[model samples]
Target: MIAATADAAEPDSARQRELVRLVRQDCGSCHGMTLKGGLGLPLTAEALRDKPFDGLVATVVYGRPGTAMPPWKTMISENEAEWIVRQLMQGFPEEAR
Candidate 1:
Protein backbone atom coordinates (compact mmCIF):
# COMPACT_ATOMS: atom_id res chain seq x y z
CA MET A 1 0.00 0.00 0.00
CA ILE A 2 2.77 2.41 0.89
CA ALA A 3 4.60 1.52 -2.25
CA ALA A 4 1.49 2.03 -4.34
CA THR A 5 1.02 5.41 -2.77
CA ALA A 6 4.60 6.35 -3.34
CA ASP A 7 4.12 5.66 -6.99
CA ALA A 8 0.64 7.13 -7.44
CA ALA A 9 0.20 9.80 -4.80
CA GLU A 10 2.17 12.51 -6.47
CA PRO A 11 0.94 14.03 -9.70
CA ASP A 12 3.40 13.73 -12.59
CA SER A 13 5.51 16.67 -13.64
CA ALA A 14 3.21 17.54 -16.54
CA ARG A 15 0.13 17.24 -14.38
CA GLN A 16 1.82 19.26 -11.67
CA ARG A 17 2.69 21.95 -14.13
CA GLU A 18 -0.89 22.07 -15.34
CA LEU A 19 -2.15 22.14 -11.78
CA VAL A 20 0.07 25.09 -11.06
CA ARG A 21 -1.35 26.88 -14.05
CA LEU A 22 -4.91 26.17 -12.98
CA VAL A 23 -4.25 27.35 -9.46
CA ARG A 24 -2.48 30.48 -10.57
CA GLN A 25 -5.06 31.32 -13.19
CA ASP A 26 -8.38 29.76 -12.22
CA CYS A 27 -7.95 30.00 -8.44
CA GLY A 28 -6.04 33.21 -8.74
CA SER A 29 -9.04 34.58 -10.59
CA CYS A 30 -10.41 34.99 -7.09
CA HIS A 31 -7.50 34.41 -4.72
CA GLY A 32 -5.46 37.11 -6.50
CA MET A 33 -2.62 36.56 -8.94
CA THR A 34 -0.17 36.88 -6.09
CA LEU A 35 -2.52 34.93 -3.83
CA LYS A 36 -2.68 38.03 -1.70
CA GLY A 37 -6.47 37.96 -1.57
CA GLY A 38 -9.33 39.26 -3.68
CA LEU A 39 -12.75 37.65 -3.81
CA GLY A 40 -11.18 34.95 -1.66
CA LEU A 41 -8.83 35.04 1.31
CA PRO A 42 -5.09 35.49 1.08
CA LEU A 43 -3.08 32.34 0.44
CA THR A 44 0.37 33.58 1.28
CA ALA A 45 2.78 31.43 3.25
CA GLU A 46 2.60 33.79 6.18
CA ALA A 47 -1.17 33.88 5.92
CA LEU A 48 -1.41 30.09 6.00
CA ARG A 49 1.32 29.43 8.59
CA ASP A 50 -1.21 29.30 11.41
CA LYS A 51 -3.92 27.61 9.35
CA PRO A 52 -4.93 24.00 9.74
CA PHE A 53 -3.51 21.99 6.85
CA ASP A 54 -6.34 19.46 6.88
CA GLY A 55 -8.95 22.14 6.74
CA LEU A 56 -7.16 23.67 3.82
CA VAL A 57 -7.31 20.35 2.04
CA ALA A 58 -11.02 20.04 2.71
CA THR A 59 -11.62 23.51 1.42
CA VAL A 60 -9.77 22.73 -1.76
CA VAL A 61 -11.40 19.39 -2.27
CA TYR A 62 -14.84 20.13 -0.85
CA GLY A 63 -14.88 23.89 -1.02
CA ARG A 64 -16.75 26.16 1.35
CA PRO A 65 -20.48 25.86 0.87
CA GLY A 66 -22.45 28.95 -0.07
CA THR A 67 -19.24 30.62 -1.09
CA ALA A 68 -17.70 31.56 -4.40
CA MET A 69 -14.92 29.03 -3.82
CA PRO A 70 -15.94 26.05 -5.84
CA PRO A 71 -14.83 22.48 -5.18
CA TRP A 72 -11.81 21.52 -7.24
CA LYS A 73 -12.26 17.82 -6.50
CA THR A 74 -13.45 17.17 -10.01
CA MET A 75 -10.18 18.46 -11.34
CA ILE A 76 -7.70 17.40 -8.66
CA SER A 77 -6.95 14.38 -6.49
CA GLU A 78 -6.37 14.25 -2.74
CA ASN A 79 -2.62 14.07 -3.15
CA GLU A 80 -2.73 16.93 -5.58
CA ALA A 81 -4.77 18.96 -3.16
CA GLU A 82 -2.23 18.24 -0.44
CA TRP A 83 0.53 19.34 -2.76
CA ILE A 84 -1.27 22.56 -3.56
CA VAL A 85 -1.69 23.30 0.12
CA ARG A 86 1.95 22.61 0.75
CA GLN A 87 2.93 24.89 -2.09
CA LEU A 88 0.64 27.64 -0.88
CA MET A 89 2.17 27.39 2.54
CA GLN A 90 5.63 27.61 1.04
CA GLY A 91 4.97 30.68 -1.14
CA PHE A 92 3.83 28.44 -4.02
CA PRO A 93 5.89 28.38 -7.21
CA GLU A 94 6.41 30.51 -10.24
CA GLU A 95 4.59 29.72 -13.47
CA ALA A 96 6.19 27.01 -15.57
CA ARG A 97 9.03 28.51 -17.57
Candidate 2:
Protein backbone atom coordinates (compact mmCIF):
# COMPACT_ATOMS: atom_id res chain seq x y z
CA MET A 1 0.00 0.00 0.00
CA ILE A 2 1.28 3.49 -0.82
CA ALA A 3 1.66 6.01 1.96
CA ALA A 4 -1.01 8.67 2.29
CA THR A 5 1.71 11.25 2.77
CA ALA A 6 3.66 10.25 -0.30
CA ASP A 7 5.35 13.24 -1.89
CA ALA A 8 4.25 14.10 -5.41
CA ALA A 9 7.37 14.19 -7.55
CA GLU A 10 6.38 15.77 -10.79
CA PRO A 11 7.84 14.23 -13.92
CA ASP A 12 9.97 16.12 -16.42
CA SER A 13 8.53 17.60 -19.61
CA ALA A 14 9.29 14.59 -21.84
CA ARG A 15 8.21 12.13 -19.19
CA GLN A 16 5.04 14.07 -18.58
CA ARG A 17 4.22 13.90 -22.27
CA GLU A 18 4.74 10.14 -22.26
CA LEU A 19 2.65 9.74 -19.13
CA VAL A 20 -0.20 11.61 -20.73
CA ARG A 21 0.08 9.39 -23.76
CA LEU A 22 0.02 6.25 -21.60
CA VAL A 23 -3.06 7.52 -19.83
CA ARG A 24 -4.86 8.35 -23.03
CA GLN A 25 -3.88 5.22 -24.93
CA ASP A 26 -2.85 2.27 -22.75
CA CYS A 27 -5.22 3.11 -19.91
CA GLY A 28 -7.88 4.25 -22.31
CA SER A 29 -7.90 0.78 -23.83
CA CYS A 30 -9.84 -0.51 -20.82
CA HIS A 31 -11.17 2.61 -19.12
CA GLY A 32 -12.58 3.72 -22.47
CA MET A 33 -11.09 6.09 -24.99
CA THR A 34 -12.98 8.92 -23.38
CA LEU A 35 -12.53 7.43 -19.94
CA LYS A 36 -16.27 6.86 -19.69
CA GLY A 37 -15.99 3.17 -18.80
CA GLY A 38 -15.80 0.07 -20.95
CA LEU A 39 -14.19 -3.07 -19.56
CA GLY A 40 -13.07 -0.86 -16.67
CA LEU A 41 -14.82 1.82 -14.64
CA PRO A 42 -15.01 5.47 -15.71
CA LEU A 43 -12.03 7.59 -14.69
CA THR A 44 -13.58 10.98 -15.12
CA ALA A 45 -13.27 13.56 -12.39
CA GLU A 46 -16.90 13.10 -11.45
CA ALA A 47 -16.48 9.33 -11.31
CA LEU A 48 -13.42 9.46 -9.06
CA ARG A 49 -14.50 12.43 -6.98
CA ASP A 50 -15.16 10.44 -3.84
CA LYS A 51 -12.25 8.03 -4.18
CA PRO A 52 -9.48 8.27 -1.58
CA PHE A 53 -6.02 9.23 -2.87
CA ASP A 54 -4.21 6.36 -1.20
CA GLY A 55 -6.82 3.90 -2.33
CA LEU A 56 -6.46 5.06 -5.92
CA VAL A 57 -2.69 4.71 -5.66
CA ALA A 58 -2.98 1.22 -4.25
CA THR A 59 -5.41 0.22 -6.94
CA VAL A 60 -2.94 1.34 -9.58
CA VAL A 61 0.02 -0.21 -7.81
CA TYR A 62 -1.48 -3.53 -6.76
CA GLY A 63 -4.49 -3.57 -9.09
CA ARG A 64 -7.82 -5.27 -8.34
CA PRO A 65 -7.29 -9.03 -8.18
CA GLY A 66 -9.89 -11.12 -10.05
CA THR A 67 -10.79 -8.08 -12.09
CA ALA A 68 -9.55 -6.84 -15.46
CA MET A 69 -7.50 -4.10 -13.82
CA PRO A 70 -3.90 -5.23 -13.96
CA PRO A 71 -1.15 -3.95 -11.65
CA TRP A 72 0.68 -0.87 -12.99
CA LYS A 73 3.33 -0.67 -10.29
CA THR A 74 5.86 -2.21 -12.61
CA MET A 75 5.09 0.30 -15.31
CA ILE A 76 5.09 3.37 -13.08
CA SER A 77 6.76 4.53 -9.92
CA GLU A 78 5.10 5.27 -6.55
CA ASN A 79 5.48 8.97 -7.28
CA GLU A 80 4.17 8.54 -10.81
CA ALA A 81 1.19 6.62 -9.46
CA GLU A 82 0.56 9.41 -6.97
CA TRP A 83 0.72 11.94 -9.77
CA ILE A 84 -1.77 9.94 -11.79
CA VAL A 85 -4.14 9.60 -8.84
CA ARG A 86 -4.12 13.35 -8.37
CA GLN A 87 -4.69 13.91 -12.07
CA LEU A 88 -7.65 11.51 -12.10
CA MET A 89 -9.08 13.12 -9.00
CA GLN A 90 -8.79 16.51 -10.66
CA GLY A 91 -9.95 15.31 -14.06
CA PHE A 92 -7.50 13.45 -16.24
CA PRO A 93 -5.74 15.48 -18.92
CA GLU A 94 -7.25 15.59 -22.37
CA GLU A 95 -5.73 13.85 -25.35
CA ALA A 96 -4.08 16.39 -27.66
CA ARG A 97 -4.85 14.42 -30.77
Candidate 3:
Protein backbone atom coordinates (compact mmCIF):
# COMPACT_ATOMS: atom_id res chain seq x y z
CA MET A 1 0.00 0.00 0.00
CA ILE A 2 1.43 3.35 -0.97
CA ALA A 3 1.11 5.87 1.80
CA ALA A 4 0.26 9.52 1.19
CA THR A 5 3.19 11.78 1.92
CA ALA A 6 2.82 15.08 3.72
CA ASP A 7 3.34 17.55 0.87
CA ALA A 8 3.87 20.42 3.29
CA ALA A 9 7.43 19.12 3.58
CA GLU A 10 7.99 18.02 -0.02
CA PRO A 11 9.79 20.15 -2.59
CA ASP A 12 7.47 21.78 -5.15
CA SER A 13 9.36 20.40 -8.14
CA ALA A 14 9.24 16.83 -6.83
CA ARG A 15 5.55 17.13 -6.08
CA GLN A 16 4.89 18.47 -9.54
CA ARG A 17 6.61 15.53 -11.18
CA GLU A 18 4.84 12.98 -9.05
CA LEU A 19 1.47 14.63 -9.68
CA VAL A 20 2.05 14.54 -13.42
CA ARG A 21 2.86 10.85 -13.35
CA LEU A 22 -0.17 9.99 -11.27
CA VAL A 23 -2.57 12.06 -13.37
CA ARG A 24 -1.28 10.58 -16.59
CA GLN A 25 -1.01 7.00 -15.40
CA ASP A 26 -3.51 6.44 -12.61
CA CYS A 27 -6.20 9.09 -12.83
CA GLY A 28 -6.15 9.88 -16.53
CA SER A 29 -7.71 6.54 -17.39
CA CYS A 30 -10.99 7.48 -15.75
CA HIS A 31 -10.86 11.19 -15.19
CA GLY A 32 -10.15 11.76 -18.89
CA MET A 33 -6.81 12.17 -20.62
CA THR A 34 -6.47 15.63 -19.12
CA LEU A 35 -8.11 14.93 -15.74
CA LYS A 36 -10.62 17.72 -16.34
CA GLY A 37 -12.84 15.09 -14.74
CA GLY A 38 -15.23 12.73 -16.48
CA LEU A 39 -16.90 9.94 -14.55
CA GLY A 40 -14.95 11.05 -11.51
CA LEU A 41 -15.10 14.43 -9.84
CA PRO A 42 -12.62 17.12 -10.81
CA LEU A 43 -9.28 16.70 -9.02
CA THR A 44 -8.67 20.34 -8.45
CA ALA A 45 -6.85 21.59 -5.38
CA GLU A 46 -9.77 23.83 -4.57
CA ALA A 47 -12.06 20.82 -4.47
CA LEU A 48 -9.86 18.59 -2.34
CA ARG A 49 -7.36 20.70 -0.44
CA ASP A 50 -9.60 21.14 2.58
CA LYS A 51 -11.11 17.66 2.50
CA PRO A 52 -10.15 15.08 5.08
CA PHE A 53 -7.65 12.40 4.05
CA ASP A 54 -9.81 9.55 5.30
CA GLY A 55 -12.80 10.67 3.20
CA LEU A 56 -10.70 10.69 0.09
CA VAL A 57 -9.37 7.23 0.92
CA ALA A 58 -12.85 5.87 1.40
CA THR A 59 -14.10 7.23 -1.92
CA VAL A 60 -11.22 5.68 -3.81
CA VAL A 61 -11.59 2.29 -2.17
CA TYR A 62 -15.37 1.99 -2.12
CA GLY A 63 -16.39 4.47 -4.84
CA ARG A 64 -19.66 6.31 -5.12
CA PRO A 65 -22.19 3.53 -5.74
CA GLY A 66 -24.69 5.65 -7.66
CA THR A 67 -22.01 7.30 -9.74
CA ALA A 68 -19.95 6.15 -12.69
CA MET A 69 -16.94 5.69 -10.43
CA PRO A 70 -16.10 2.10 -9.67
CA PRO A 71 -14.71 0.69 -6.48
CA TRP A 72 -10.95 0.25 -6.67
CA LYS A 73 -10.43 -1.91 -3.62
CA THR A 74 -9.17 -4.80 -5.71
CA MET A 75 -7.15 -2.77 -8.16
CA ILE A 76 -5.31 -0.43 -5.79
CA SER A 77 -4.42 -0.70 -2.15
CA GLU A 78 -6.05 1.84 0.15
CA ASN A 79 -2.78 3.57 0.85
CA GLU A 80 -2.02 3.92 -2.83
CA ALA A 81 -5.33 5.66 -3.40
CA GLU A 82 -4.59 7.90 -0.46
CA TRP A 83 -1.30 8.85 -2.01
CA ILE A 84 -3.02 9.67 -5.28
CA VAL A 85 -5.58 11.80 -3.49
CA ARG A 86 -2.79 13.71 -1.77
CA GLN A 87 -1.18 14.39 -5.11
CA LEU A 88 -4.51 15.50 -6.56
CA MET A 89 -4.98 17.95 -3.75
CA GLN A 90 -1.55 19.44 -4.42
CA GLY A 91 -2.26 20.10 -8.13
CA PHE A 92 -1.22 18.54 -11.42
CA PRO A 93 0.47 19.70 -14.60
CA GLU A 94 -0.72 22.79 -16.47
CA GLU A 95 -2.35 20.54 -19.04
CA ALA A 96 -4.55 19.06 -16.34
CA ARG A 97 -5.95 22.45 -15.45
Candidate 4:
Protein backbone atom coordinates (compact mmCIF):
# COMPACT_ATOMS: atom_id res chain seq x y z
CA MET A 1 0.00 0.00 0.00
CA ILE A 2 1.07 3.61 -0.55
CA ALA A 3 2.63 5.30 2.46
CA ALA A 4 0.83 8.51 1.56
CA THR A 5 0.48 11.63 3.65
CA ALA A 6 -0.95 15.08 3.09
CA ASP A 7 2.60 16.40 2.95
CA ALA A 8 3.79 14.31 0.03
CA ALA A 9 6.28 16.11 -2.15
CA GLU A 10 5.40 17.07 -5.68
CA PRO A 11 7.22 15.53 -8.61
CA ASP A 12 10.16 17.44 -10.09
CA SER A 13 9.57 19.78 -13.01
CA ALA A 14 10.77 17.31 -15.64
CA ARG A 15 8.74 14.44 -14.24
CA GLN A 16 5.76 16.72 -13.87
CA ARG A 17 5.88 17.38 -17.58
CA GLU A 18 6.02 13.67 -18.26
CA LEU A 19 3.04 13.02 -16.00
CA VAL A 20 1.10 15.70 -17.84
CA ARG A 21 1.72 13.99 -21.13
CA LEU A 22 0.74 10.61 -19.69
CA VAL A 23 -2.54 11.99 -18.46
CA ARG A 24 -3.27 13.88 -21.64
CA GLN A 25 -2.38 11.09 -24.00
CA ASP A 26 -3.07 7.88 -22.09
CA CYS A 27 -5.73 9.01 -19.67
CA GLY A 28 -7.29 11.46 -22.09
CA SER A 29 -8.15 8.64 -24.41
CA CYS A 30 -11.00 7.75 -22.05
CA HIS A 31 -11.45 10.80 -19.84
CA GLY A 32 -11.62 12.92 -22.99
CA MET A 33 -8.97 15.03 -24.63
CA THR A 34 -10.12 17.83 -22.33
CA LEU A 35 -10.87 15.57 -19.31
CA LYS A 36 -14.50 16.65 -19.51
CA GLY A 37 -15.72 13.05 -19.83
CA GLY A 38 -15.84 10.23 -22.35
CA LEU A 39 -15.71 6.51 -21.80
CA GLY A 40 -14.33 7.46 -18.40
CA LEU A 41 -15.78 9.90 -15.92
CA PRO A 42 -15.00 13.61 -16.19
CA LEU A 43 -11.86 14.56 -14.35
CA THR A 44 -12.69 18.24 -14.19
CA ALA A 45 -12.15 20.06 -10.94
CA GLU A 46 -15.87 20.66 -10.70
CA ALA A 47 -16.65 17.00 -11.12
CA LEU A 48 -14.10 16.09 -8.47
CA ARG A 49 -14.82 18.90 -6.05
CA ASP A 50 -16.83 16.83 -3.64
CA LYS A 51 -14.92 13.62 -4.18
CA PRO A 52 -12.34 12.31 -1.75
CA PHE A 53 -8.76 13.22 -2.57
CA ASP A 54 -7.06 10.06 -1.32
CA GLY A 55 -9.65 7.92 -3.03
CA LEU A 56 -8.88 9.52 -6.33
CA VAL A 57 -5.19 8.92 -5.78
CA ALA A 58 -5.92 5.29 -5.00
CA THR A 59 -7.94 4.99 -8.18
CA VAL A 60 -4.98 6.27 -10.14
CA VAL A 61 -2.55 3.94 -8.47
CA TYR A 62 -4.72 0.86 -8.06
CA GLY A 63 -7.51 1.57 -10.54
CA ARG A 64 -11.18 0.65 -10.27
CA PRO A 65 -11.52 -3.07 -10.75
CA GLY A 66 -14.11 -4.39 -13.22
CA THR A 67 -13.70 -1.20 -15.23
CA ALA A 68 -11.53 0.01 -18.06
CA MET A 69 -9.35 1.99 -15.63
CA PRO A 70 -6.26 -0.07 -15.42
CA PRO A 71 -3.82 0.29 -12.54
CA TRP A 72 -0.87 2.58 -13.16
CA LYS A 73 1.17 1.29 -10.22
CA THR A 74 3.75 -0.18 -12.50
CA MET A 75 4.29 3.14 -14.23
CA ILE A 76 4.03 5.60 -11.33
CA SER A 77 4.97 5.80 -7.70
CA GLU A 78 2.40 6.55 -5.04
CA ASN A 79 3.75 10.04 -4.58
CA GLU A 80 3.52 10.68 -8.29
CA ALA A 81 -0.07 9.49 -8.28
CA GLU A 82 -0.85 11.88 -5.43
CA TRP A 83 0.66 14.74 -7.38
CA ILE A 84 -1.45 13.93 -10.41
CA VAL A 85 -4.62 13.85 -8.34
CA ARG A 86 -3.78 17.24 -6.87
CA GLN A 87 -3.23 18.69 -10.32
CA LEU A 88 -6.41 17.15 -11.64
CA MET A 89 -8.45 18.55 -8.78
CA GLN A 90 -6.98 21.99 -9.43
CA GLY A 91 -7.35 21.78 -13.21
CA PHE A 92 -4.78 19.53 -14.83
CA PRO A 93 -1.96 21.28 -16.62
CA GLU A 94 -1.45 21.16 -20.35
CA GLU A 95 1.55 19.29 -21.68
CA ALA A 96 4.55 21.53 -22.32
CA ARG A 97 5.07 22.17 -26.01
Candidate 5:
Protein backbone atom coordinates (compact mmCIF):
# COMPACT_ATOMS: atom_id res chain seq x y z
CA MET A 1 0.00 0.00 0.00
CA ILE A 2 2.99 2.26 0.08
CA ALA A 3 3.08 4.95 -2.55
CA ALA A 4 5.47 7.50 -3.90
CA THR A 5 5.45 10.78 -2.01
CA ALA A 6 2.89 13.31 -3.16
CA ASP A 7 5.64 15.63 -4.26
CA ALA A 8 7.38 12.91 -6.21
CA ALA A 9 6.14 13.58 -9.65
CA GLU A 10 6.64 11.09 -12.46
CA PRO A 11 9.74 11.96 -14.37
CA ASP A 12 9.48 13.41 -17.86
CA SER A 13 10.31 11.23 -20.87
CA ALA A 14 13.82 12.55 -21.23
CA ARG A 15 14.51 11.94 -17.54
CA GLN A 16 12.97 8.51 -17.77
CA ARG A 17 15.39 7.66 -20.54
CA GLU A 18 18.25 8.96 -18.45
CA LEU A 19 17.08 6.93 -15.50
CA VAL A 20 16.84 3.85 -17.66
CA ARG A 21 20.41 4.27 -18.78
CA LEU A 22 21.59 4.80 -15.22
CA VAL A 23 19.98 1.61 -13.98
CA ARG A 24 21.05 -0.45 -16.95
CA GLN A 25 24.63 0.64 -16.60
CA ASP A 26 25.26 1.40 -12.93
CA CYS A 27 22.88 -0.95 -11.18
CA GLY A 28 23.40 -3.58 -13.81
CA SER A 29 27.03 -3.75 -12.82
CA CYS A 30 26.17 -5.43 -9.51
CA HIS A 31 22.68 -6.68 -10.27
CA GLY A 32 23.98 -8.29 -13.48
CA MET A 33 23.73 -7.00 -16.99
CA THR A 34 20.49 -8.93 -17.24
CA LEU A 35 19.42 -8.13 -13.69
CA LYS A 36 19.22 -11.88 -13.16
CA GLY A 37 21.79 -11.79 -10.34
CA GLY A 38 25.45 -11.12 -9.76
CA LEU A 39 27.29 -9.68 -6.78
CA GLY A 40 23.80 -8.46 -5.91
CA LEU A 41 20.63 -10.51 -5.86
CA PRO A 42 18.37 -10.82 -8.88
CA LEU A 43 16.21 -7.79 -9.67
CA THR A 44 13.80 -9.69 -11.84
CA ALA A 45 10.13 -9.07 -11.20
CA GLU A 46 9.70 -12.51 -9.71
CA ALA A 47 12.61 -11.97 -7.37
CA LEU A 48 11.10 -8.71 -6.11
CA ARG A 49 7.48 -9.78 -6.28
CA ASP A 50 6.84 -10.16 -2.58
CA LYS A 51 9.14 -7.43 -1.39
CA PRO A 52 7.79 -4.20 0.10
CA PHE A 53 7.61 -1.60 -2.63
CA ASP A 54 8.52 1.34 -0.45
CA GLY A 55 11.50 -0.51 0.93
CA LEU A 56 12.79 -1.05 -2.55
CA VAL A 57 12.52 2.66 -3.24
CA ALA A 58 14.25 3.41 0.03
CA THR A 59 17.02 1.01 -0.82
CA VAL A 60 17.55 2.74 -4.11
CA VAL A 61 17.66 6.09 -2.38
CA TYR A 62 19.40 5.22 0.87
CA GLY A 63 21.11 1.94 0.03
CA ARG A 64 21.88 -1.01 2.27
CA PRO A 65 24.65 -0.12 4.62
CA GLY A 66 27.55 -2.54 5.00
CA THR A 67 26.71 -3.96 1.62
CA ALA A 68 27.82 -3.24 -1.90
CA MET A 69 24.69 -1.17 -2.49
CA PRO A 70 25.44 2.49 -2.37
CA PRO A 71 22.94 5.29 -2.00
CA TRP A 72 21.94 6.90 -5.27
CA LYS A 73 20.10 9.78 -3.64
CA THR A 74 22.80 12.03 -4.97
CA MET A 75 22.02 10.97 -8.50
CA ILE A 76 18.26 10.37 -8.58
CA SER A 77 15.21 11.72 -6.85
CA GLU A 78 12.97 9.58 -4.66
CA ASN A 79 10.30 9.67 -7.33
CA GLU A 80 12.79 8.45 -9.88
CA ALA A 81 13.72 5.68 -7.48
CA GLU A 82 10.07 4.73 -7.23
CA TRP A 83 9.81 4.68 -10.98
CA ILE A 84 12.76 2.35 -11.20
CA VAL A 85 11.22 0.00 -8.65
CA ARG A 86 7.98 -0.10 -10.57
CA GLN A 87 9.88 -0.89 -13.76
CA LEU A 88 11.89 -3.63 -12.08
CA MET A 89 8.78 -5.19 -10.64
CA GLN A 90 7.11 -5.21 -14.03
CA GLY A 91 10.20 -6.34 -15.96
CA PHE A 92 12.70 -3.57 -16.39
CA PRO A 93 12.94 -1.95 -19.78
CA GLU A 94 16.04 -2.37 -21.88
CA GLU A 95 18.34 0.59 -22.21
CA ALA A 96 17.28 2.55 -25.26
CA ARG A 97 19.59 1.88 -28.20
Candidate 6:
Protein backbone atom coordinates (compact mmCIF):
# COMPACT_ATOMS: atom_id res chain seq x y z
CA MET A 1 0.00 0.00 0.00
CA ILE A 2 2.78 2.40 0.89
CA ALA A 3 4.63 1.54 -2.29
CA ALA A 4 1.46 1.93 -4.29
CA THR A 5 0.93 5.35 -2.81
CA ALA A 6 4.46 6.37 -3.55
CA ASP A 7 4.16 5.13 -7.10
CA ALA A 8 0.99 7.12 -7.56
CA ALA A 9 2.61 10.37 -6.49
CA GLU A 10 4.03 12.72 -9.11
CA PRO A 11 7.69 13.60 -8.99
CA ASP A 12 8.19 17.02 -7.37
CA SER A 13 9.58 18.77 -10.43
CA ALA A 14 6.99 17.32 -12.78
CA ARG A 15 4.19 18.10 -10.36
CA GLN A 16 5.39 21.69 -9.98
CA ARG A 17 5.51 22.21 -13.73
CA GLU A 18 2.14 20.55 -14.24
CA LEU A 19 0.59 22.70 -11.53
CA VAL A 20 2.00 25.83 -13.14
CA ARG A 21 0.64 24.79 -16.51
CA LEU A 22 -2.80 23.91 -15.24
CA VAL A 23 -3.16 27.11 -13.24
CA ARG A 24 -1.97 29.13 -16.21
CA GLN A 25 -4.40 27.41 -18.58
CA ASP A 26 -7.51 26.22 -16.75
CA CYS A 27 -7.56 28.24 -13.53
CA GLY A 28 -6.93 31.46 -15.38
CA SER A 29 -10.42 31.48 -16.86
CA CYS A 30 -11.86 32.25 -13.44
CA HIS A 31 -8.90 33.13 -11.27
CA GLY A 32 -7.65 35.49 -13.97
CA MET A 33 -4.89 34.83 -16.47
CA THR A 34 -2.55 36.42 -13.98
CA LEU A 35 -4.12 34.82 -10.91
CA LYS A 36 -4.51 38.34 -9.65
CA GLY A 37 -8.11 37.44 -8.93
CA GLY A 38 -11.25 37.92 -10.98
CA LEU A 39 -14.69 36.54 -10.27
CA GLY A 40 -12.84 34.71 -7.53
CA LEU A 41 -10.44 36.07 -4.94
CA PRO A 42 -6.88 36.74 -5.93
CA LEU A 43 -4.60 33.74 -5.79
CA THR A 44 -1.79 36.20 -5.37
CA ALA A 45 1.03 35.91 -2.87
CA GLU A 46 -0.57 38.26 -0.41
CA ALA A 47 -3.85 36.36 -0.57
CA LEU A 48 -2.54 32.81 -0.24
CA ARG A 49 0.72 33.41 1.54
CA ASP A 50 -0.56 32.07 4.84
CA LYS A 51 -3.18 29.56 3.70
CA PRO A 52 -2.62 25.96 4.73
CA PHE A 53 -1.90 23.21 2.26
CA ASP A 54 -4.80 21.03 3.40
CA GLY A 55 -7.26 23.86 3.05
CA LEU A 56 -6.07 24.62 -0.43
CA VAL A 57 -6.33 20.95 -1.40
CA ALA A 58 -9.89 20.76 -0.14
CA THR A 59 -10.80 23.85 -2.09
CA VAL A 60 -9.35 22.38 -5.25
CA VAL A 61 -10.86 18.91 -4.85
CA TYR A 62 -14.30 19.86 -3.60
CA GLY A 63 -14.55 23.56 -4.46
CA ARG A 64 -16.89 25.92 -2.68
CA PRO A 65 -19.93 23.70 -3.33
CA GLY A 66 -22.45 26.50 -3.66
CA THR A 67 -20.24 28.98 -5.43
CA ALA A 68 -19.07 29.41 -9.02
CA MET A 69 -16.13 27.20 -8.21
CA PRO A 70 -16.51 23.60 -9.37
CA PRO A 71 -14.88 20.51 -8.00
CA TRP A 72 -11.91 19.49 -10.14
CA LYS A 73 -11.60 15.81 -9.36
CA THR A 74 -12.77 14.81 -12.82
CA MET A 75 -10.31 17.09 -14.55
CA ILE A 76 -7.31 16.68 -12.25
CA SER A 77 -5.83 13.74 -10.41
CA GLU A 78 -5.53 13.82 -6.62
CA ASN A 79 -1.78 14.12 -6.79
CA GLU A 80 -2.01 16.83 -9.36
CA ALA A 81 -4.58 18.62 -7.27
CA GLU A 82 -2.24 18.57 -4.28
CA TRP A 83 0.54 19.83 -6.49
CA ILE A 84 -1.62 22.76 -7.47
CA VAL A 85 -2.23 23.51 -3.82
CA ARG A 86 1.49 23.53 -3.26
CA GLN A 87 1.89 25.93 -6.11
CA LEU A 88 -0.75 28.19 -4.65
CA MET A 89 0.96 28.25 -1.29
CA GLN A 90 4.25 29.01 -2.97
CA GLY A 91 2.77 31.70 -5.19
CA PHE A 92 2.45 31.59 -8.97
CA PRO A 93 5.50 31.15 -11.11
CA GLU A 94 6.50 33.97 -13.47
CA GLU A 95 5.86 31.77 -16.48
CA ALA A 96 2.43 30.77 -15.17
CA ARG A 97 0.91 34.04 -16.28
Model 5: per-residue Cα lDDT over 1-97, one tens digit each: 2334678688989999998888888898999878999999999999999999999999999999999999888888888898899999999999888
TM-score of each candidate structure, all chains considered together: 0.89, 0.87, 0.62, 0.90, 0.90, 0.76
RMSD of each: 3.6, 3.2, 5.3, 2.5, 3.8, 3.8
Q: What TM-score would you give candidate 5 relative to the actual structure? A: 0.90
What 10-residue stretch in candidate 3 is worst by lDDT? 2-11
**Clash count, one per candidate:** 0, 0, 0, 0, 0, 0
Runs of candidate 6 with Cα error greater than 4 angstroms are 1-8, 11-18
Q: Per-residue lDDT for 41 in model 4?
A: 99
Best by lDDT: 4
Candidates in order have lDDT scores of: 0.87, 0.84, 0.67, 0.91, 0.89, 0.74
By summed lDDT, the worst window of 10 consecutive residues in model 1 runs over 1-10
Q: How would you order the candidates by lDDT, starting with the best?
A: 4, 5, 1, 2, 6, 3
- Candidate 2 lDDT, 1-97, residue by residue in tens: 4433355658767777788889889999999878898899999999998888899988988899999999987788878887888888888888566
Model 4 segments more than 4 A misplaced: 1-7
Model 1: per-residue Cα lDDT over 1-97, one tens digit each: 0112354467789988998898899899999988999999999999999999999998998889999988888778778888899999999998977
- Look at candidate 3 and give me any clashing residue pairs: none
As for TM-score, the candidate ahead, 1 or 3, is: 1
True lDDT of residue 87, candidate 5: 96
Error of 3 at 83 (Å): 0.8
lDDT of 1 at 92: 91
What lDDT is obtained when candidate 6 is compared to the true structure?
Answer: 0.74
With candidate 2 superimposed using the best TM-score fit, by how many Å does residue 44's alpha carbon deviate from the native? Answer: 0.3
Candidate 6, residues 1-97, lDDT tens digits: the string is: 0112355566477657776777876888888978988888888868888788788877887789889988887767667777676766777675633
